[model samples]
Target chain A: MDETIEGSFQIIGGNFANAGEASMQLKSKLVELGIDEAIIRRAAIATFEAEMNVIIYAAAGRLQYYITPHEVTIKIDDMGPGIENIELAMQEGYSTAPDWVREMGWGAGMGLPNMKKNSDEFKIDSVVGEGTTVKMIIHFS
Target chain B: MKLSSIVESISLEVKTGKNNLQNDVTGVYISDLLSDVMANSKEGNIWITLQTHLNIVAVAGLKNLSGIIIVGNRQIQQDVLQKAESEKITVMSTPLPAFEVAGKLYQLLNG
Candidate 1:
């Protein structure tokens, strides 16, 4: 395990077409770093869910990662209409994505649950009408 | 079944990479959305969709997908084709809809 590996991506809002870029980059990088596939998939799921939130919900956001021998941490911060109910939002099958988003076969509301399910540690903070911030960590241990 | 068989069944045109259709495939998935594909696709699965985008190749790379079959006779963006070529991702297209391709693949593979 490399003691130091880091990556950062600036995910844009409303660019639903390119929403998965960051996670894709992260996945390739992890493979190059020789990280475990399961670990890579876990981090990818969390980061992708958070990134998509920024694209569909937030106006824009940044996905930043901090890597170490022990863990891979991903943080997504977005500026959008904040969630009114984090608890309900965390539940599966809840989404507010636009018609086109759904037409593309997404917005099924499985994003949050899948993110949480894949990560070792997950945190969410949001203020209605303000914005949202998400943090996820997956330890190699 | 080999991609050659799928092509014959669906009347698909091997727009590029004819050598690619020679690859063996075990299953098929039809989806336009990228994330859903990322989560569900297994290696050696041929994906059929109407989505023609650059990122689709990236998703195929991550999932280790066998190839992509674009529906609706959609014109694949040039940039997307270039990336697919570099990645060695097989590309095929059919005028059929996503549902028909899915059904055909299911029939061939499941039978």
Candidate 2:
């Protein structure tokens, strides 16, 4: 395969109604492009987790996707109160989400870990007062 | 077994997406957390949950799930029902708890 396709989506924080819309659209595009079903599922799940993070934690964010013959790359940057402890955040069952957020059946403290589990490669960086940025890559064979 | 069969066997109420009742269900995942379902649920699995959000339909679509069975007869908002219908994902309901529905589904699929 020889191709380059790139897309970007903006996510508003606290937008519960459209939380996972970006991931759903990305999954549909992958399906239309005939990506492997397994790969698509993995990428879709990862994307959804990242998208939810933006909605639950950030003020606003943007998710960018770049697809090539070899891999799909997702870069998400959000403006919000960043994580104080990256290591603790990566641990499952550690969440800072408020009660209202959890009431929506999310904020299970699984978002970042779940994204890492689904992606072939995952990296996250955050500044306590600034924001967070995540880089995830999923390779296709 | 077909999702419709599961509905018939369990006497589930078809809230919407009835057209997709013939879809095959290969497995079942019981969860209310969206991320848990996203990370672990497999394609063609019948997701049993109490979530009545539109995002559930979106997750079911992205995961290619067979259908969603809302337990406890929780009222799904109109938008969620519409989204499930448009996604062509079967949405059903049961007054029983998630465990009871899961047990019934497991027996039907395994026995």
Candidate 3:
């Protein structure tokens, strides 16, 4: 718990088959580190939501995590069309995902809110034509 | 109650993770939305949904759900069943809709 642990995972967009792999890996890593079960669950949920966002919207992305004694930090950086309206995107049940994605039981517009709810601290940055970056921190106490 | 007991009582079809039928059912969560399940489902809860996609397996695994009940006898893909097996998450199908399945499960668990 004293030393810092870090890791990174690649996320391929539109790969529904492999979606949430990064989050799953992160969850396993946290479990291996012997973190608290509740903390691990929150971290896992936040990271999974971020991973899904990249898969559903971006072309590709990287999920990186840093685990310290006090907190677990997750960052997702992707290459895809960014959100035009952060406010609207942050609202619950507001999604721009196409019908195909909706048909697959996703795109309910709860991803961002879920991430924020699970994380002790959350931040999102995006450019209209470029991409989006999401950062979340879960405190371990 | 154990998952195998519920399956037997309800006549649900076992698709995969047959060996995992011994898992103890903590509760039931009915949702087709992946994020909703991710956000709300507790560990050991059984998820009931109409989704047959591979990501359902991922959600079940992430939440550490006891199992998945695919209601309405939805046609689950072969790959989905395989993934569920690998994840060690029991997935069953039933001809009944979500409402009926939920009702039966509620009685068994709370009755």
Top lDDT prediction, candidate number: 3
Off by over 4 Å in 1: A1-3, B1-111
Writing each residue's lDDT as its tens digit, candidate 1 over B59-107 gives 8889878789988766666777888888888888888888888887777
Q: Candidate 1 on A19-134: residue-level lDDT in tens?
A: 78989888887788788888898888888888888888777888898888778889888888998898877865556666567666677667888889998999999988888888
Error of 2 at A29 (Å): 1.8
* Candidate 3 residue B95 C-alpha distance from true site, Å: 27
Docking class of 2: incorrect
> How many clashes in each candidate?
0, 0, 0
Candidate 3 off by > 4 Å? B1-111
Docking class of 1: incorrect
Reference-based lDDT, each prediction: 0.81, 0.87, 0.88
User: What does candidate 2's lDDT look like per residue over B1-111, in tens digits?
Assistant: 888888898999998888888898899999987888999999999999977656788999999999999888676667778888888888998899999998887788877
Off by over 4 Å in 2: B1-111
Q: Tell me the tens digit of each residue's lDDT in model 2 across A1-141.
A: 577888999999999899788888889888888999999999999999999999998899999999887889999999999999999888665677875686687866678888999999999999987999999999987
Give the Å error, residue A49, model 2.
0.8
Ranking by TM-score: 3, 2, 1
